[model samples]
Target: MAILKQYKKSDGTTAWFYKLYMGKDPITGKERRTTRRGFKTKKEACLDLARLQLEIESKGLNNNSVRTYRELYNLWMSQHTLNIRNTTEQRVRNYFTNQILPSF
Candidate 1:
């Protein structure tokens, strides 16, 4: 869904803005939203919002993959272990392998 609103700019002029719901994050389960401002008129905001909706409808939000817990864990560990010490990294790997992977 999209919502349109008008607000006074710093120059004391009325401008239009829009708020759009993009959907949820697959990994975090959080609602995703985007806000665009500084449109000159409500029609301009509505046009931009319609274009964005068309793009999203055509592109489908880019969430086509279904990843398992192990895949997600490996992906996380690849980036997360970069700055950590080898011992700490090993501890984290062990914790995930022993305590986390089994439950999932």
Candidate 2:
């Protein structure tokens, strides 16, 4: 869904804006939103919305798969260990799990 809006700017200039709902994030299942402003005409906003919708339909709502950070970390670790040595892999994995995955 998208809505066009008209508002007064801080400089007292009228502008056109649009808020486009980009659907839920696959990883978090939260609603995604995007807004663009400063369009001089509604036609520009409409055209941009059309382009965005096409891209969303072609690609996806969100690329992530609703996996938790731990799940994603394990998935990435599996791929990362494919060509690496066992010792180095363990060190790297430890670093990520301790210093990085927790943040996510």
Candidate 3:
């Protein structure tokens, strides 16, 4: 399906909003539904939707409380490791442990 659906933004600009059905909310005990909107094109809207889906599946986008920076750093460290040297990795780890972890 073509991802772009057009809608009017609050600023009166033409925009595309993607509508996806997210499953029900667990805590509020209410049926949950939301829309990701205000993109300028269908491609943008679809890409946004895909990102939202990924974040939701990854437990990074909690509806109740925002994720702490430490949690995000750990998540990033788990998923991404490129050609960086061991020293770089250690430095990153140390930074996270000392700076980010203590704040949250």
Candidate 4:
């Protein structure tokens, strides 16, 4: 579901904003949220929300989001390592290689 808000921008123009619930994150199993800001009209926001709903229904909560767990894990690790410390990243890499990858 999505909720709409009418907010005044820094430039003093009123715009529509919406927060959409995009199901769970594949790696975290936590709620994933997507927000869009600065729509010119409420109707436009409504239309976009409708489109998202149709996509969710036609595909699934994940919306054909990813194909496999291994592929997903690889993609996740690639992005996750960029912001973390080197030692922590290496430890995670080792754990995945030694303990996790074998199970897959």
Residue-by-residue lDDT tens digits, candidate 2, 28-104:
88999999899878888888889988998998986657468888778878888998999999899889978997787
Candidate 3 Cα misplacement greater than 4 A, ranges: 1-4, 8-13, 60-63, 66-104
Worst 10 residues of 2 by lDDT: 61-70
Model 2 Cα shift for residue 31 (angstroms): 1.1
| True lDDT of residue 90, candidate 4 | 90
Ranking by lDDT: 1, 2, 4, 3
TM-score of each: 0.56, 0.56, 0.47, 0.54
**What tens-digit string does per-residue lDDT give for candidate 1 at 1-104?**
88899999888999999999999877678888999999998899999999999988887666545379998898889999988999999999999999999999
- lDDT of model 1 at position 89: 98
Q: Tell me the spans in candidate 1 whose CA falls farther than 4 Å from its real position.
A: 63-104
In model 3, the clashing pairs are 4-42
The superposed Cα distance between candidate 2 and the true structure at residue 77, in angstroms, equals 23
In angstroms, how far off is 76's CA in candidate 3? Answer: 26
Of 1 and 4, which scores higher on TM-score? 1
Superposition TM-score, candidate 3 onto the true structure: 0.47
Taking the candidates one at a time, how many backbone clashes does each contain?
Answer: 0, 0, 1, 0
Write candidate 3's Cα lDDT for 6-49 as tens digits.
98767788988866666666765565557776678878887888
Candidates' lDDT values, in order?
0.90, 0.86, 0.71, 0.86
Ranking by TM-score: 2, 1, 4, 3
